[model samples]
Target: MATSPGSDIAFASQKSMPSENLRTKKLPLSEEEVFYMNCRAVYLTVFKSSLENIISKDQLYLALQHAGRNPSQKTIDKYWTPQTAKLNFDDFCVILRKEKPTSKAELLKSFKQLDVNDDGYILHTDLYKFLTKRGEKMTPEEVNTIINLPNINADGKFDYIKFCKLYMTTSGQCLKTALERLQVDSKQRRQQFGSHMEELPARDPSSVLKPSPRILRNSDQETLSNRGDPRASLLSTARKFKASVTCTISMAANGNQNAKLTEPNLKDWPGVQSRGCFFLEDDGETVSHQYRLHMAQRSTVHLTIKPLNLSQVEGKLSPWSSVDTALYILKENEDQVDPQLVCFTDLQHREGFGWTGELTPGLYRLLPSTSGCRLRKERTPEPEEAQLVCRDDAGDLFLTQAFKAALSDVFDVIDLDGNGFLSLEEYNFFELRTSGEKCGEEAWLLCREHFDTKKNELTRQGFMDLHLMEANDREGDPCDLWVTLRAMGYNRALELKEACPFVIDLHAERCKPRLKAVRMEASRGQLEKATCQSVLLQGEARAMDGYENVLVHTRSWDFRITSVIENKSDNKVIIHINNELSKNCVNNRGLNVFAVEVAPQSSMVCQHVMPLNEHQEWVHHCVYSLISS
Candidate 1:
């Protein structure tokens, strides 16, 4: 028989009859197995704290000695080393001081008290006393600079209000910096606390906190004596097992109280903030909005939110949640709307794709793997929407010409006759009346036949009256022809009025200053304005058409003014007229003054009354030369 080494087993027992039992009851031999065995034994003991509690170096060394590690003092210093303790002493006090002061009034009072000097200002001398009283040793110059800021009153007094404000602002800035640093340090501590430790689940379903065995053991006798219900026998047994204990035992419970405790004060880890733009479209118009959010790094994102119902979204086309749906709706309802949607993440990167389908208005969430998104209305220009009115000084070219072409198509459809002019009757086909007075049903039908389908071409003058002029019934005057021409889109209508030639025929009885009569020929453009200019030539009396005619020219701006001659029948007719600058100066290239005069009862013509400057294009010069030729 042999005894096991280092154990107190007697050699006699080894040789005894329990050999089979000893062989069956062997202990675990690995370090982990041994530690767990010791842990179990310690758990059974009356231990007052958690297994994760910090163990002192001496206690740890004692345990190591129990396991047979007997190194020298210096070696043990390296082995049983103490950690650099966390700098959290008075941490709450530090936090308290870092908090912003609540009441500004108190700070101002304190500042005023610290000012010390009865003299209105706090100077270097004043600050010395103040700092000494406060046990602070700031430089006098710094104190003086603070006290002497521009905000000091006109009397050079450092008001306590200003001083308190400045001090609060400066102190808050310093506190903010310090707190930021402290926060970073605290975050690092939290990371280190969890770094090497076994991970705890965010939630625990199996463990509950219960009273330790000591409480059961101490309460067992009393619990058994007072047990009123037979169903509480287990509770009585539990009482017998634990007494006078406040231990938080981690064990499985069937109820819902098994989860681990979490602090509500703790915040989620800060992540990156990103912004994206999105659009809402209604009818043909699209409005935009931006989405900014803080997102977890390297994590999946699930966004589901409703669109903002902005007031600017009013229109026939409602903003659809999905771009594809909106596009489909736009195409299907082309007769109703020309819908477009545009998205822009970056202005510089404008390559966009569209979806072909109709989408109804509602909220939709976009799911993307990336950090941000931007959607905006695709700014599609409808040049055809621009009014069809012609440009006077210059015709619409390039983009405008495209618009004009569309208008021309519309006009062709409206003009029924193949004639080169749009008559008043033909113009009525488009629901545009030629006169203020209502026309008959026959006139409307005739207009449709002549203008709506005939695709007739209309002259510019006829077009002006048919499309542009509005009937003006003021001062018994027929109409304002110039306004109509303007609305009709002729830029040079004024110039046209100035350039229209006029002729007048006058007849009178001989010598008695008899009643005078005169007749004039006026263009349609002139007649629109109800004005005409004519010169009366001085010559021998002749038949109504035989009066000697002298050519003279006249230009007028006010259409209302009509010139008349007196005593036209008797004596020889003498010319008395005025020369004036014609308004129809097409070549407004530079400064100019032109003159025109019309003889009495005479025909007149004046053409090309415009000034050309050095800046005028060579093309203009060529046109002028051609016209002159």
Candidate 2:
């Protein structure tokens, strides 16, 4: 009638009475004999060792098998005899996977969960509430010993959680010993069950293993309990168990295609730089399951980093401080995915800015960028531009796909006059402007003096150049767009996408501010042809690199450059350079080649660099004119 799915079904059946009666019979063995009996049970169950051997010869294999199975000490001694105390204390630890958490906060939380009553004390009722419903109540002495504390706390009440923790750590040895003792009790019960079976009719072997009270009818429980205790003598002869540390190795992928597990001797293993191991859907080759390795002590294992064929790691390495080089392996073939770089909880870790360490002896990962020395400020998340790149849920990079449709639209619209390539006039119309008219007042003001009201048509490369020149004027020739972008490191983006063809539609939308148009008679050889641009802008002036200078607006301002050209006498002279944002300060506009100080016979290239500040605005005009005196 147990409602809970896990409730004891054996206890419910009347036919199981024989097993119940057999289970209740106590064995005559002393506590010590009982303990070794438990050890024997574990050894036999896990490593197939017998009780006689476990009690006499402290075989290492039996101990290893015990540890590997992680059996409780009670289980360990379940089938052991009196003489099996030869196991060391360290050897007992092999049977345990986790040492309880050492952190105080975590321990306290565990205690509170067990202490169901808010009264702050763990009483018998609280203990019942904490343990399984079917668990038997502990005797008064057992409870006191389990929760023994000198001061119990200021309130003089034992904190069950704290007591359990203290007991688990301090009394773990004793508890293990006690569990081993229980093994003897279980054996006595089995014997009583066997005796009761002798009185019943022959049955199947499997049925004998099943619980039935009838099996205990003929068993003399009291006489068995009176038998001379063999546990005491066995405890005296058996060696006391000692605890020791060990390690485990878990491979992320079993049969790798390119990577191989060299001989177990890890001292000479070479680690390669690779993408390492990553989780994937269960495709037989790349298993994504997390493999675990828990070692007895952190220092017992030494991880060595051996450099393989790769130099430093190929990707940015600063962010992954917790990753070690052993977690990575270079790919064997170009067609294959890059060598895998993997990391684990203790197997891989970063100890310093550039240095990482691993504990697994094997060549687990490839060491990447040695130190933070190679990391540039722009490469990492700095205060100025944090979260620059978009990342997906799994931290995979998201690439911006080029707008092919946009490009097609641009080619369709800008290829005006059916020439298949945009002319300066055609480009102006697409930008919402007349071919040969000055921008309206609102647009002109937005543009600095870079826009010339006098000139009607802007030749190609005039759009963004004018905007750059004006923005520079306001900032006192402070770092302009090109210089700032270069310094900020847009070069990396350009390189990653350089191979993709430029989407004309995207260019129309994103590159609007940088384009320009101006009237220039091109050499006859340079006719109409659609081609890629290679304009390189380097100075504070001539901000527009290749496009026509199309000004959205205009404002009167001084434009500066690296150098200025001066004419000794009044004469028409023109100085031209590609990708230069130079303008004359006199009219607060583009330089007038005719009005410059040019002599009738001689001309001068004003080599003095123009000052970008406000105060120096009048110097260029004043210096040459005054010297005429």
| Candidate 1 lDDT, 303-342, residue by residue in tens | 1222212123455321322121110001113243322221
Error of model 2, residue 16, in angstroms: 48
RMSD of each candidate?
A: 46.3, 37.3
lDDT against the true structure, per candidate, is 0.25, 0.26
Q: What RMSD value applies to candidate 2?
A: 37.3
Give the poorly placed runs of model 2, Cα more than 4 Å off: 1-41, 44-48, 51-156, 161-206, 209-275, 278-353, 356-629
TM-score of 1: 0.18
lDDT, candidate 2, 368-470, per-residue tens: 2111111122333323321222336875433222222222333343333333444434443333311223234444333323333224333223332443332
The most accurate candidate by TM-score is 2
After the best TM-score superposition of candidate 1, give how far the Cα of residue 104 lies from its true spot, in angstroms: 4.9
TM-scores of the candidates in the order shown: 0.18, 0.18
